[model samples]
Target chain A: SQQGEEDPQALSIQEGENATMNCSYKTSINNLQWYRQNSGRGLVHLILIRSNEREKHSGRLRVTLDTSKKSSSLLITASRAADTASYFCATVKGDSSYKLIFGSGTRLLVRP
Target chain B: DTAVSQTPKYLVTQMGNDKSIKCEQNLGHDTMYWYKQDSKKFLKIMFSYNNKELIINETVPNRFSPKSPDKAHLNLHINSLELGDSAVYFCASSQDSQPQHFGDGTRLSIL
Candidate 1:
């Protein structure tokens, strides 16, 4: 079953603009991870934020997690045309969980 | 080289036929998994194998089976495929169950 639900199913933004995606999941998770998928390809891991952590950043990506509300957000700064892809949030529940439950994903389109 | 790879990127088969999608991960991870993405783009976990042992199995039908010949390879075999079974099956791997790496996915079409 899918644990996460992302808001704004589709997002369109101009190049250099900032894109933010929100995800809400049920149940307690050990960590939440964000992934990016290009058209007709596999998903690539973006960043992971642990339940004990509030926020994390990697280059142009910033991820914030709120355990109390079971919600998380991913922000991409200075979006580029190459950033056009579907973004998904996955959760790892329980201790030493082996499987990941993914969200429906947010389709991001960056117009150059 | 691809870290996680699945064979036959695309498969079109008639309903009720049996087929298998092969997956191999060279990352030497201890865990591997299979997930199905439906037409609506909802990804759900089907199975997970750790060190050639079944760890996680969701409410998937018995028609779908995962076989791990070794720690590096996990294959999914389906029997009596149905129209509803048409979806993109992804193979993924992770070490100690952290961030996982996914394959290009196999698009299965049941006709």
Candidate 2:
């Protein structure tokens, strides 16, 4: 079953602008991870935030997790045309399951 | 070197035909997985293996069989393929609970 649901099925933003995507999950998770997939390519891990951690950052990518709300957000600062791609949120259940339940994903288009 | 690689980036065949997709990882990871992405871009786990042992098997059909000849190799074979099997299949590998590294994907189209 799918555990995560991302908001704004699609988003269009201009270069240099900031893009934000939200993800909501249904169950308790050991960790939440954000991945990016370019057109015709595989997914690349962006950042992972543990349930006990509220926020994490990698370069221009910032991720926040709120276990109380079972929600998380990914923010890309100074978006570039290369940032245009589909972003997905995946959850690892706290039950020691190795499977990753992925969301439908958010398609982001960054215009140059 | 590619951390994970899958063979036959694209596969096109008719229904009722049998086909196989092979995957290998050079990261020396203990766990490997196979996922399918539907037309709607919904990704789902099909199977997982750890140390050459099947560990996670989702509600997939029996027509789909996975084989792990060794810890670094995992292959998926489908028999009597159907049109519904047309999708992008990805192979991934990881160590324990760490993040996974995925292959580009195999775009399968069944007529």
Best by DockQ: 1
Q: Each candidate's fnat, in order?
A: 0.92, 0.79
TM-score, model 1, chain B versus true chain B: 0.99
Whole-model alpha-carbon lDDT for candidate 2: 0.96
Across residues B67-111, which tens digit of lDDT does each residue of candidate 1 receive?
Answer: 999999999999999999999999999997678999999999999
Using lDDT as the measure, the top candidate is 2
lDDT per residue as tens, model 2, A1-112 = 5789998899999999999999999999999999999999999999989999999999999999999999999999999999999999999999865889999899999999
lDDT of 2 by residue, B11-84 (tens): 99999999999999999999999999999999999999999999999999999999999999999999999999
| Steric clash pairs (candidate 2) | none
Against the true structure, candidate 1 has what lDDT? 0.94
DockQ of 2: 0.86
lDDT of 2 at A81: 98
